[model samples]
Target: MSTRRYILDTNVLLQDPLAIYAFDENEVVIPAVVLEEVDSKKRNMDEIGRNARYVARLIDELREEGKLHLGVKLTNGGTFRVELNHRSFGKMKEHFLERTNDNRILAVALNMRIEEEEKQSGITVTLVSKDALLRVKADALGIHVEDFLSDRVVQYDRMYTGYKELSSESKQIDELFENKKLLIKDSPISNSYPNQFFILKDEVNPSRSALGMTSKDGNYLESFVSSEEPIWGIRARNVQQRMAFELLTRDDIPLVTLAGKAGTGKTLLSLAAGLYQTEDLQKYKKLLVARPVVPVGKDIGYLPGEKEEKLRPWMQPIFDNLEYLFNTKKPGELEQILAGMGSIQVEALTYIRGRSIPEQFIIIDEAQNLTKHEVKTILTRVGEGSKIVLMGDPKQIDHPYLDEYTNGLTYVTERLKHLSETGHVKLQKGERSGLAQMAADLL
Candidate 1:
């Protein structure tokens, strides 16, 4: 097959410099502006900055072999080049957002398209970018564009859950649980990949069923959450939410992380159970909600404000939920409830450092924004009598380094979902609204 030319955008390099390996050794092109862009971000403190430094080192190592401007042979056997199509900006339109970097990257791809047309052969100068808006603009210019497909979900509604159910005799079920594995028919109960864990409920009593794990190839993946706790919220909106309620309200399940797309109700359901426990059941001394203050693409530094003012952007969703929960109360009534109980705390992840929390129902929103080290720090800070709930949509991460599968939230879910003390449920339905769910689906 003829090689496909992929013009890597700055975001792709900032996301994963090694993304060049995924295209079947196709010819990869990095615009010169993208290199300069990576250089400027090399010193950033976040994941993007780390990726910047990584890409630069990668290019430097390749230069040791041959000229970068001409072409360098990638370890994947693909030829790569740093395109330097420097043309006078005086000929192009400038706008108030002239400082916008995306346009410059798109310009390089556009120039490549022109060069290809001059060669008397049809060359597809496809602009590969993660920025949705950039892809939209490229379409306006009649250029082929695509987003990197590696991190995409299998289906908009699908997620990796480690549980499968079987309809065996009670004796067979007993044998499976005793062995801690099962080979049931490939239903929801048996339809899991390696490392996926599940609790095979009675489907009748749900509480009476045994716990079994599916194998790596669904070869009887083994693990269970027999963590004993009082049942609550049995009538949750979805089966997944009901399962999540069972997980979050348990004390033996010391750590629970829920991950999925936005509007999947990860934050809402966790907070609901936390509130029900801390305020109504009086199981914990406090209910805490906190999240990393990272923005999806940028931080709030450009917007002038004090801590509360600056934090308004990150904490707005938290407040919106609180608003809905306390819908009947007057404005600020929820804040008063928080103060009266001293029970509910909506905090920043930074302030949580070095603190040991006990007897608390803690919800860490946006856990995906946290690095593995940061997540470890938060998790290790848990004292006795604390049930920590970490919730975030890994697919919607703001941190530059991690993706859907690699973020700390997903990392923890993958590693800990098999134990008896931890329970995980990925809510696939977006119950927020029709538009919200549709947007979460298509966009």
Candidate 2:
């Protein structure tokens, strides 16, 4: 079999610093222009910048083994090389931009493909990138292209919803309600997660149903734990919300992920649950809420104020939910409320790194904007006695290099769904308002 050569895009390496070793027994090539792009972003204060520096260090370390231009042996039995753009600008100007970084990267891939063709070698050269446009351009130029799929957890449509409905004997479901717990093996379900919620319907009577969750031991299916209790002056509006509340309020389950569309009350329910745990129950010492600083549209430049002031816009949605939770009557009163309480901290994901947070209810909003690496960094920062809730809509990702399936929220939910300490719920109905729901559905 002929070994395939993969030409990686800058975003691919920056997305995963260890991407160089992902392809086993295959050749890996990095365009010289990609290194320049990586260098320009090394000073960024976000995860991308951190990954850029890490990739630079990785490549530098690889250079020590041998000359990068000539190629070096990788631990995975692959060869790594930094290839220069050998094709003339005029050759690619017809199909791509004259001198853009993307086009230059394409030129390197094109050069590799042509060289292999001239030698009549049966080897395949494929361009690996996270950028959709780059892949499209490569297709137009007749170059093989693919996404870096190593980091993808699952397909978006097939992502775990954390809830399963099964038809069982009326006696079995009745046993669930009467006994409050049933052995998982007795049911038709084969696999069960630690906190996986279920809707058991009687096969004979479709109307007969019961709501249950996998026991903390992951062996038995049991009823919800105080599912009817109102959380922070808010009641669970639907079945999924009720399930989420059960998972959120449980002290044993330290990790929870909520995925749904906008206005499905993911953020509101998370904040309310955090308040219930931190303020009312005193399960945790404080509440720390954060979201990635990904913009929906073009950036509007820097804001004119201090750090807090600059963050007000990004954190306003959180404050809005807090105000609703506090039921503040006056405008700006939420600020005073938060100040007086002094237990809640709203910050950006950028500064959350390098800090050990213990005994806090950490809620990461818009978590879908994060990569798998970013999600790991955030989850690893949780100290002892801390519970972290990741809330996001898989369809609402704003990261350019991420998709619904590859985002951190989906990654964490799919990867950790089976753990006893982890729970997940995909909210279905939107509870914001009629107009908002209509817009969510129509537009």
Candidate 3:
């Protein structure tokens, strides 16, 4: 097969520093303008900055092997080079006169296509980028463009819901209810993941149903174990919420992920379970609630105040749930209540790095805004005797580089579904209210 050239954009590298090695036996071209873009972001103190520095270091190491401008051999049997000669705007200036870094990168890809066609080298050139507008422009200019797909865990439509429905015999459903555990071999499901929930219906009468979950060993489908009792004055309003409660309250499961649309009760249920475990059952020492501070629309810039005051705007949604759980209606009353209760801690995910948290009920709200690497960093901080719950609406992601399928919450749910110590639930019904549910569904 003829070799193909893949020109990468700066966002591709910043999104994943190891993207250069993803193309096997194909030439990877990094436009010199892209390097300049990376350099501009290297001083940032966030994840983007870290990725920029890492990419720079990787390219620097490659420079020692051979001249980067000339090209260097990659470990994956691919060639890497910094394309400097394609700096001219050329025909691209006729359309995009902005002379932006994005246009510069596009120029390189456009020039390479022209060069290959002129030489009749039979080499296909493609532009790999995460920017939608850039991809459109590249296509208009008659260049092939593709999204960075290496980090995507699953398609959004086919994403794991953590629950499935199965048809079983009436006798088997009765047996499952009677014995409390039915062998998987006798069920309709040919295979089952650990902690996966099931809605078993009688094949003869579909309405005759029972809720069950796969045994940690994947051998038996056991009945749901959570009681009907209200947790922190909150009861599971639906089957999926019940499944989420079962996963959240289980001490053996250290990792629980809940994904849903807005008003699906993901956050309220997680918060209730965390409070019950930490405050009522005395299972955990603290209830640590946190979320990524990703703004929905345009940012309002920085706020002036101490840490707690600064976090109030970003954390108000969490506080609304807390006030409801605590039954505190007065303004500023929740703050005083929280201050007295040392075991309950609400903070931002920013400070969670490099800290070992043990014996805590941790709830990471708005987790869909996090990247896979950010999720790994947060999970690695969990010490012994800690349960971390990740809950978010994948469809409502606010992160610039993340989408429904590529967000951290979706990545964790898909990757860790088979682990015995992990549980996941995708809440479909919105329990917040009629208007909220309608908005979530129709809007």
Candidate 4:
């Protein structure tokens, strides 16, 4: 195939500035507007802003090797150049080029398509973006548009719910649960994870069975261990969320994994259960909450204030959930409550290495942004009396190299789901506002 030229939208650059490297040695184009957009966001300190700055530095490094407009060779041996040419289309009205940034990005994609159409060398110029509306507009213009499916849900539905049900003979169910490792011969559950949970029932009677899961080797299935205590005032509204809560609170289950889409309440429910168990029940001495420092909406560092003030932006989501759970109508009540407990702690996972934490309830949110090594480092820090809950919507990840299946969250789910002491749940319901749920479903 001739060289494929990929034009990155501003969102793409902001999300994973190094994303240009994913196209192999193909020619990559950064639209001039995308640079302007990224430059504007580079001053911020959140993940997106950090990514923009990183990409800017990367481009600078490349410029030192060659001309920026003439195309510079990347570390991967691929060539990339910035595109500044802009032409109004006959089919598009001037309104399309107004003050909005999304439209300009779309226009650039259309222009690239026009120039590529003249080549006829099988040289494809595709618009890479995360905005659904932009993709729709590009499609209407006969220009190739894609939603940077870089988040990588190969079979979006393949996202599993760490739990399954297997109907077996009543005698088989008893034997499997009673034994340490009841190896089965080609059982259908052979494709499951180590700590995953399963409900084994009689073939004739749906209710006559036991809850179990397969081993890491995909052989035996066993029961699940719920978090230290059943979280009162916290229960799953849906079957998946229920399963998620059950896994999140398990004490025997040292590593609990959760996957879901936005508004599924994965993060909220996990925090609620962690708080209930750690603060109320004293299942663990302290509750340690940490995330991968991946920013979702805008950057945080650019906003003024100290670390605590800077953290409010990142900690806002956590505070939102805390506010809801505590039924606090006033502002700052959640922080005060968490502070009063002295048992609840919120921190970033950046400096957790070499620090052994025992007797703690560790909740890692936005785990999708974590690398395999990073997750392993955090998981290994768990000491006795400590249970760790890792939750994130793999589809909405912020990391660059990590994808849906290959991410650390999925890696742990794949590696530990078979253990009887570990479990996983994928939240599918979005209990948030109707618009949020609709956007999650449609987009």
Candidate 1 residue lDDT tens string, 148-204: 865442333344563445544566567676776656566555544433445555644
Residue range 1-443, candidate 4, lDDT tens digits: 32688888877766566688888888888877788888897886545566778988988887898778888877777888887775444445643646467777767777667766776677787888876677887788788877666544344556567777677887777776677345654867777665666767799887786766565567676554453234656656665675677666656677788788888888778888887777677888988887655543233446688767777667678878778778898777777887777887877666455699999888888888876656777888999888888888777767644567656787777666546667788777798878999999997
Clashing pairs in 3: none
Q: Which ranges of candidate 2 are over 4 A from the true structure?
A: 295-302
Of 2 and 3, the candidate ranking higher by TM-score: 3
lDDT of 3 by residue, 126-214 (tens): 99999999999999999989999998989648888888988888988998999998888754553878889889889999888999988
* Candidate with the greatest lDDT versus the true structure: 3
Query: What does the lDDT come to for candidate 3?
Result: 0.88
| lDDT of each candidate versus the true structure | 0.71, 0.86, 0.88, 0.73
Query: What's the ranking of the predictions by lDDT, best on top?
Result: 3, 2, 4, 1
Query: How large an RMSD does model 1 have?
Result: 6.9
At residue 347, give the lDDT of candidate 1.
77
